[model samples]
Target: MTAIITTTSSATDTATLEPGAEAPANAGEAAAAASEAGAGAPALTGEHTDLLETLARHRFFLRFTTKDLTDEQAAARTTVSELTLGGLVKHVALTERRWMDFVVRGGEAFANGFSEREAEFRLVEGETLAGVLARYEEVARRTEEIVAGIPDLGAGHPLPEAPWFEPGASWSARRVLLHLIAETSQHAGHADIIRESLDGARTMG
Candidate 1:
């Protein structure tokens, strides 16, 4: 189930990033800028003008938080729980793979060890923080490739077998992408709070 996030800010024009900074020239720059901005800044690029701006924004958030941390730091718990910045990265990667493979491709089976759909938020023992981040990066790259290869965002794909998903129902590629963006963005918020609570690191620009 999707969690409801209530904000006083306007949803249509909410600032996901700081003003005065130039839009990133590439994914690396975008990812770095997102880390500096923390969760307070816009997740999307101000100069972004694409059919997949929403998807890009969501990707920005995921990459930003997962960028530039030492394996130990990424895995370190700021609180009493098992959630870590790295763990969140893994979770997003797992979700991306599942959505793309199951919902988008209508695949009945998935590759082993990439993720466990039933255990969202639960980090398994012996899963190194670095390993999780690396896997997340790989999965994200694959997802990007898949999205780019699609000729039409309006093209339909089968739905997963869930109560929320209708049997034999299909979704436009656009909807699937948007759902990913929204899902990642929300989790990024959770990561932001967890990071801050751990070390008092404020959100970046």
Candidate 2:
């Protein structure tokens, strides 16, 4: 079995953003640490700034899809697939959290198992739309904090041993950020469809 290394504690010192809050003062510094830097990480460059802006834009769309929705409406499956507005928000939060963990802890991030991947897609009993959105905001804030503190976007770790990943290949922190943006964007589109189906709401004109 692969060893599980804990990286969640790294974010303990970072400040949390409230729901719909803007990125913190230190947001968008993309690069893994060559050594611990925390709040003292270097200022953002054009690339990192652009990356964060694009990510924030897509994130806005994703969250906006759930606007004005009741828990029941958010949980309703509008498409043939199991996808729902609340579920998409929850899943995106989970995905972002895990990838940030990988950035800090590397391949050991997967040690938690795949069960979380499935469960986050639905609002389990007693779960609310407000709750999931709050969690997503927390995750997003953590991502910004992690990215802003790390010192080397060029730093990489070997890919986890999975069928979906190429053997022996690795990804830099930059790659991971791009992947996050893409993942969020894709899901945001799916969310648009679901929202439109639910009440003819579209993310765009």
Candidate 3:
């Protein structure tokens, strides 16, 4: 097993961990710490700003895709194994593609092209971590470009397959961007915990 050291520093105290470290087991304690740290933060600008800020904060976890680690190391799991930083990047890329392609672009259903959307959770053989990360960046950039091109939030787009999205259902492009940001931010939290367990490398700082 490989190891990495992490240091937690405060005004007057410092603590160190060995390569294989167990995070504080108390969930409440962890939540409390995070809440205390965020207490004085100013109000967020808007829905888009709030969501984008959340996603940017977790970009550190994406760095693991380029780090020297195997699929197992990225996942930090031994049993019922299925999760990795690379896999998460792939998943996010596919997710962004699906939302933009299907929901926004109103194209052919991805389900026909990729039978299992959740396959992103499994790392396929021959797929390098670097390649996955690169693809993720590409998709993210494209999504941003598409979002920038949209000028109206009330524009109606056809959703041929979405039951809830009726043919005339309209949504602002801003709403879609915010939704994607929220989704990515949620997954980034998952990546943070998985990465920390993998090598004791803290994702937050």
Candidate 4:
């Protein structure tokens, strides 16, 4: 369990304590403390700013693919994958939120968002396109907060043990941000094809 925990109460009072126990490791925590600073300040320059911009632009393109879509159209699956535009939007938004939460709270963030795999990619009944878009906006705002506030791009925790991931692999905050951008861009492409199939709509003007 490679977790970087610190007291939320104070910055100068930083320490990596064992889970459920309180003990300060002054020397080891020095790097960790510096790594977590600027959580409340603006993110300017460096990789964080670049990643934020890239993701924002890609997300804009993704949203554009679904413009002028009706609830029926958004929910209609145009591909054999059984993926709807609305569902893709939901997935990207949830993924961004989850990755950003990881930046703040590490592996624990996964439990906060989607619990079931099917629910993530499925558009349930009574789910309005407007409502999902609104939720997506909320997630985008939080994603921006994460990219702007978290101090260290290099800071990371070991990935949860899983066969899907390399054993003992870890993802730096930077890598996580890049992954978000990649996923968003990829889904945006999917949305484009789905939109084109739905009513000959295209993201490219």
Scored by CA lDDT, what does every candidate get?
Answer: 0.55, 0.71, 0.51, 0.67
lDDT of 4 by residue, 1-205 (tens): 1111111214423332222332233323432453355355433566765676567566666665666678888889888978889999988888877777777887787754346558767678888787887788678767666656667789998777556889988999889978988998899889878887787755633
Selected candidate, larger lDDT, 2 vs 4: 2
* Best first by TM-score, ranked: 2, 4, 1, 3
Name the weakest run of 10 consecutive residues (lDDT summed) in model 1.
1-10
Candidate 1 all-Cα RMSD = 10.5
Of candidates 3 and 2, the better by TM-score:
2
Runs in model 4 lying further than 4 Å from the true structure: 1-43, 112-114
Q: Is candidate 1 or candidate 2 better by TM-score?
A: 2
Candidate 4, pairs of clashing residues: none
Ten consecutive residues with minimal summed lDDT in candidate 4? 1-10
Taking the tens digit of each residue's C-alpha lDDT, what string does model 2 give over 1-205?
A: 0001111222312433233332323222211221133345444656666666567667766776776789999999988989999999999889989988999999999886667876789999999999998888678767777777767788989989999999999988899999999999899889988887887766533
Q: Tens digits of per-residue lDDT for model 1 on 1-205?
A: 0001111112311233222232234343443343343355333222222434445455555445544466666777787777778778778877877767754546453335334655556456677666775676566655655665666667765655556667887777677667787888788777766666655553332
- Ten residues in sequence with the least summed lDDT for candidate 3: 1-10
* Local error of candidate 1 at residue 160 (angstroms): 3.1
Clashes of each: 10, 3, 1, 0
lDDT-superior candidate, 1 or 3: 1
Give model 2 RMSD, 1 decimal: 9.3
Arrange candidates by lDDT, highest first: which order? 2, 4, 1, 3
When 2 and 4 are scored with TM-score, the better candidate is 2
